[model samples]
Target: MEIRHNELIQMYPIGYVHNIFKEAIFDEKMYSSVSHIVLKEEFQDGLKDITDFSKIYVLFYFDRSEGYNLIQKRRYDGKIAGVFASRSPRRPNSIGLTLVELLEVKGNMLTVRGLDAIDGTPVLDIKPFIENDMAGDDLRSA
Candidate 1:
């Protein structure tokens, strides 16, 4: 899991998210927001069979975050915590992940609900959401 210091890493977006959300929000509206994932024409074939899942994980970039702090106050509670402990967009890699409800798929586009990403966000990757990965019968309280 370790790479050489001189190694180079690169990634190209296969698609972009289209939505009405213009800013960061963590409200009830977010749960109802409908967004579209439009994949490049070349990647259209990748959408095949994706509709079988009810949910999928969206991996995207926090392209708008300016900089980051290792420690910060929680937005909802004003409590101090490490950035890693919080969901703030600012981060070491600026990558964001959200598990969203899959609604429908059309050609190279997918309609999904509950995607928190804003319009034009670059989608790094997508994965099927498997409930077995949650690890437990007893969930830990956040």
Candidate 2:
């Protein structure tokens, strides 16, 4: 499948992320920090029954990522690797996916831990994280 030259896809943000950290930093500090995913009033109904899950998968757009590099050196190890092999925000599409611990769900708002998205980041969608979503240890050796 291919998109035409003029073809375009559109997406609307259901909510924006709110967190204390302003800058995007790849570190272990986000593990304990809390973040709020405040959704629009119209989308509040979608949160029904979401609190039952312990974790959720958040799909968001990298609104702050400026450009892309197919081959770039990783920040931590300074090792050159393909863009697809690394989790660098600078990607072709600038999309981000992360599994976060769901602390609680309030009307139109979801309080979560371990969200790396910056404040005001657009949230595309959210889904409950299931065990099947992860691969087994045996598969890692394949």
Candidate 3:
């Protein structure tokens, strides 16, 4: 079956990223990039009571990523795979996700760690990762 599409869905940035990652590539090493999520003044009220959580799920946009190839070389295996199978930044839609530690929340700025998104990237949304069934990965032994 052919899947038709619509453009009714849209997203706006709730904030902007602040980090040392000037370019999309990481420092000499592959995973040394670090960034912080700084929410806009208007969204400050939405972050109330979020400090109780330790980890936050960050949703961002890869604005710098212009276009993507369906199949690209995997950084690990050096093998070409579908974009869906790998974590390459290039995508039909430039949405990005990262689970980072909520180090500290001061006003509208949130200091986080373990995120790889570029600086000035648009932050779509932020969700706290609470310890609950929905946040579990439990499964029966295979």
Candidate 4:
């Protein structure tokens, strides 16, 4: 029960991600292939029509991770987690969510694919992962 530091936590990078995941460590068997994201040129008109949703929820900005260790150690087993239940990019606020799978948008760039982020990375927002809310079928359908 401790979260009170307001500046309302703002964000602005509407676009800047192009990946092949150049490298940031974490290739323990290529974690789900499919990769490509561009999104730039004046925000590419926000990629209108979002390709009728195939799946997308990028929200990036780990900006090359910097600090945090509120309890870590869970590569999948050494359990000592609790940095918000471990998705650990070593965070005190590095912000990096990924659910990519738009596949193509061409025009300012957006061909995303299962992003794990880390290749220019700065796409602070891009939602559209709603598929029946009210607790029915979300969690990306599962």
Q: Which scores higher on lDDT, 1 or 4?
A: 1
Ranking by lDDT: 2, 1, 3, 4
lDDT of 3 by residue, 76-122 (tens): 68888998877778987888887888888889999888877878999
- Tell me the lDDT of candidate 3: 0.82
At residue 1, candidate 4 shows an lDDT of 85
Q: How far off is residue 52 in model 4, in Å?
A: 31
Candidate 2: which pairs clash? Answer: none
**Residue-by-residue lDDT tens digits, candidate 1, 18-72:** 9988776556686788999999999999888998789999999988787999999
How well does model 1 score by local distance difference test?
0.87
Task: Give the Å shift of residue 110 in candidate 3.
Answer: 0.1
Q: lDDT for model 4, on a 0 to 1 scale?
A: 0.75
lDDT of 2 by residue, 29-110 (tens): 7777899999999999989999878999899999989899999998768899899888799998888999999999989999
lDDT of 3 at 130: 64
Candidate 2, TM-score vs. the true structure? 0.85
Error of 4 at 90 (Å): 6.6
lDDT of 4 by residue, 27-84 (tens): 6433466655666577888778889899888878788778988888877787998887
